[model samples]
Target chain A: MGNLLEIKNLNVQFDIFGAHVQAVRGVSFELNVGETLAIVGESGSGKSVTSKAIMGLIPNPPGKITSGEIFFDGSDLVKYSQKQMQKIRGKDISMIFQDPMTALNPTMKIGKQIMEGLIKHQNLSKNEAKTKAAELLKLVGIPNPDKRLDEYPHQFSGGMRQRVVIAIALACNPKILIADEPTTALDVTIQAQILDLMRDIQKKTGTAIILITHDLGVVANLAQRVAVMYGGKIVETGTLEEIFYNPKHPYTWGLLSSMPKLHAKTDKLLAIPGTPPDLSDPPKGCPFAPRCPHAMKVCVDHMPDYTKLSATQKTACWLLDERAPKVDPPATIGVGGE
Target chain B: MDESREKLLQVKNLKKYFKVSRKDTLKAVDDVTFDVYKGETFGLVGESGCGKSTTGRTIIRLYEPTEGEVLFDGEEIGGKLSTKAKKNLSRRMQMIFQDPYASLNPRMMVKDIIAEGLDIHHLVKSDKERMDRVYHLLETVGLNREHANRYPHEFSGGQRQRIGIARALAVDPDFIIADEPISALDVSIQAQVVNLLQELQEQQGLTFLFIAHDLSMVKHISDRVGVMYLGNMAELAPSDELYDHPLHPYTQALLSAIPVADPKVERTRERIILQGDVPSPVDPPSGCRFRTRCPFAMEICAKARPKWHEAGKGHWVSCHLHDDGLKK
Candidate 1:
């Protein structure tokens, strides 16, 4: 249960034109051996950039990790050279992207596309990789793997294409899997199937998972720990129960209340007031001050420090400041219990 | 209620089939029937390629039906109507498309986009009147009057959707078919759009056919709901009744798949994970289209299509398991 990956004070910026767009600003978290950590946020949040930094996939010249130390299995990934990082990418750590249609090669057969990773990373023979490729397809629940493996990517449906993508990510038996919005483009029924498959695979293989999604429902059902991101910062970090039931940050409250639920009966949902902060030129004070319902005079002047709610929960909000008034979420949301 | 006031729009045995190949036919909307009461939201929920969108589009005559009738205000659309009668009918029915980015013309300004409908119907007399009406419509959807000069690219996804709503309201339509209006928006912005739609519906006394893929949002906005599967209506009931007591196996499976945000509730609820994928519409299986994945599927399910019958006072289901005319 020791830390498998620890990120400290991560800062990622992009040089758009002449100004620097600070996307990920001083974010930190830890992922244990076999636990699932979900990073939840809206579109422009830096959840994707932090994971991209770990995989060394950020395009340079415009993008740069200004400061941070990404420690993976007692080794610093930020300090690794391109050649060194290449060895660890697919062999030790794997990532599955959001859109499977664009991820897979449309012209190549499904079997060859999956076997390329095995051949390149594990140095398996042509015949050996082909046989193992079929096994991987079968493992991911694709029927008649032997016959379907030779078909091109366009022949498979959207859900099956995603399954093939999952099989590729699992081919090398990597210790960590980073899935970024794997079910965003899928239908709800297919999304449920994929979520179930990921959970089942994590249980069987004990692979530490980092699921990056905008879906709060997925985080509630899947992740052991949750990190709420806003304006490229971890505004809140806690277990699923603490984040959902007893959210301290106003942004987290907006997220929970904005989510359309099956049981809630109301004609108009309580939408958050304003848009996400512009990342190109972020505000000097609290990033979420404009949209926060409980904004104070001090909140507009200074950024809040991270306040620890418990050993496992911490939130960065001025309302959580000791001198600030004790503000609770709406009465209907209730406290952190059933 | 009387029959005239009970139904705002009634679609009977609606069919929109496409000739895929020389002999093969795709039943995109096969024998579907439903009614949208006046001033109520009728939700249609289904998976992709399940003909939910097709049904909505056909109702507005975007795709002409091969058979069946679409009656809006007690008059059959696409029937032998006089030229004046057709003109009056066009002003009463309108549709809001799925993608706001694609639905709005890129070249047109916000003012012109909203005025296009008014210009088509010649509802406005002068330039000043049209400009004032367009500005008023903008304010109605919570957009500022200054947005009239801007283009679609100038606004965010949510703002663009507000502009789309403004255009739909310009004609002053009585019935609106909102096809996944909030699906492309961000989660934070989705609530804003849904709330706006509900507010507008209430203020305008508009009948809506809200089509979406998410059951949670569907349950929030809809008064009555219909579940479609492979071009057929699988179940139809009141929103609260369907959520509490889902009868059809497909509907039960869909409801169970929705992930509740509470950990304790999620742990207590059992997820019904259906086996296999949805069959291709080009060559769907015989009888029940969901028989390939239905856990309670039987031999009769594969032999013939189940007859749509009322299982309760208002709840309707089309499955052989509940065809005995006995309420579950």
Candidate 2:
């Protein structure tokens, strides 16, 4: 199948205190229709920035797209005007934020909040919008949708508030939904419920999804394809099986090993030492070279080229460099080690 | 695995009710009882507002218990302790808060924060001695001694947490209550903090009541785990047994909800998505608080609260499904 969305050679930068901070650099990926693509990274790894760039949500003045082409349905979105982007934002692409309490307006009733999108995008009348809003609430599994529509945000629980947010996101029937850590604030059970709800909705509407999260567990079950991001770049990209079973990047290995497994029997977890590098004055070569376990002398001197492991898998690491000697990941990492 | 010794920390029918309004009392923690072994990590796992944090605070006397006796080292705390006695007992217990960012004073330097406990207890004689103790505490938590002079804002989130650990350790307490210490940290940094706590527990022979929202991490670090729901403990068991054979329906649904990192396992595993949100703590359900959302709830569940009793060796559950064996 052809790609639904393709982002090639993307670069995003911010001018802060008379210095350019390269947030995202040379990132490339493709999302197929009806596929759930996950972008996983720690804070300041530019995972959110990449998603924001794709949605044309980057705030102007300080934030700028340095160089890249974001193609949606064979049309470059980077060239679209603000007026043009506004029309496509809620109608073609929708985003769900991390905190639902803050994302939702406290004063307005949830029914009105959801109806704003339907009336604006679908051009529904007041009464028609209210009726459609209740239907959307029911679709998102809100109990007694008609009665609860009159209730304010404070009356709902954390999980229920998120369900309302999901309802708002789906009000316009967008072709793409970008959920940025929608479940991070919720408990495990509620997180599971929200993930399942998203999967079910995606199946029903055939909307492509971009799930952004720091938790690898969410990506493992929800996403069809996985993109491991680090230091403003796609360090590794592959199918879920290939990423989980045979990961090629050391950063991906650290992520897998650092996660506390529910079934594994181990005394101590293997933590990756050191923090993410400073983005203001990034290193000359590989961005993750400072924290990589298999860091070589050449890694500091030159950036490793992207090596194709398969038609669907690729990694950028010195260990994968053809001239470099093969170095295996630790034995403790079960599936993703050589 | 000795089970015959006197309990180190015994809580009897603990209750912590918060008055949200004049007419309403939120039962944040209601009618809970448990025991922590001498040198084991007792984990409290639950969702938000489930009274896990309240239970920990009530045990430590951070929040005055509405009704309960917290027997620590064979002595019941709260109102019973005289002023001098409370001061003496303060040296034996300490607590690490959840949010490292908000818990630490941004204006104070790291040394003063760690040395606050030492100064309170009068552990050090001179200023130099206090600085030495503070530096040693920083080193013990895998932080550099040079960071002693820096402010909390100068460090990263993980580093601030290390400072929090340093502060908790300065008192050299026998028991520590880590209330969701790693929940606020990054995933990569969480393991580091957990490992540090494990090592500290072993070296100091300190008992811990680790309260967290993540069940997988709780299972990894805790010897015994307790599952709480709306101010009541649903089940308590050994870590391995709790993960392997969860008896309570709430626990089964909880364990099933943890998303595995493997796609194959995730696709194949059946997830029991609970239908409703957690009932409000204020004016909670009449009998079993979890009955409102429980899939296997029976009619009797709403009539009376189930008795919390031992179902098997080292396993306890509070549910009506196990009543047949109890009756027999």
Q: Count the backbone clashes (under 3 Å) in each candidate.
A: 0, 0
TM-score of each model, in listed order: 0.97, 0.97
Residue B300, model 2: Cα distance from true site in angstroms: 1.5
Give the per-residue lDDT digits (tens) of candidate 2, residues B136-224: 89899989988988999998888888899899889899899999999888888898899999999999998999999898899999999
Query: Measured by TM-score, how close is model 2 to the native structure?
Result: 0.97
Looking at model 2 chain B, report the run of 10 residues with the lowest lDDT sum: B319-328
Which interface RMSD values do the candidates have, in the order shown?
Answer: 1.8, 2.9
Q: What TM-score would chain B receive for each of the candidates shown?
A: 0.96, 0.97
> Which whole-number lDDT from 0 to 100 does residue A225 have in model 2?
89
Span of ten consecutive residues with least summed lDDT in model 1 chain B:
B1-10
Off by over 4 Å in 2: A17-19, A334-338, B325-328
> Model 1, B241: alpha-carbon shift in Å?
0.9
Candidate 1 lDDT by residue in tens digits, B141-179: 999999999999999888999999999999999999999
Which candidate's DockQ is highest?
1
Candidate 1 Cα lDDT to native: 0.89
- Candidate 1 residue lDDT tens string, A1-338: 88999999999999998888899999999999999999999888999998999999888979999999999989899999899999988778899899998989999999999998899999999999999999999889999999998999999989999999999999999889999999998877788899989998999889999999998878877899999999999999999888888888888888888876776565567798778888889888888998888999887788888999999999999877678899878654644324
